[model samples]
Target: MKYNKKAMTKLINQHRELHDELKKIKVEMGLEKNLAIKTLFHSMVADNGPYMKEYQELERMQ
Candidate 1:
């Protein structure tokens, strides 16, 4: 299947935005605090799973 460049670029941009948001959340929650960081990391992972999975699938297809 042919992939649409514009759509793919948008998806990639969204992924980057999510990554940056995660970083900000981590910093805001206190990265030096192990407990809070761990909790936030888990939550972020769970929240980003779908997007990450979709990105991986698309990567494989390409």
Candidate 2:
């Protein structure tokens, strides 16, 4: 498999930023007691997990 180093670096950085933002939202979600918003954030956090893992895998490819 071929990979572009610069592009991968950009992707990895973006992923880190996104993950950080998601974590902040998750923290905020913890303070939320509303059932609907909590449910949405739960799903959003779940969806982000796999993508973060994928980004980690890509970043590890050298």
TM-score of each: 0.32, 0.27
Candidate 1: C-alpha RMSD to true structure equals 9.4
> lDDT per residue, candidate 2, 1-62, as tens digits?
23334433444356665446545655866644234333433443334643445545655664
Candidate 1 ranges with C-alpha deviation above 4 Å: 1-14, 32-41, 44-52, 55-62
Off by over 4 Å in 2: 1-14, 31-62
- Candidate number of the best lDDT: 1
Whole-model lDDT values for every prediction = 0.49, 0.45
Winning candidate number (TM-score)? 1
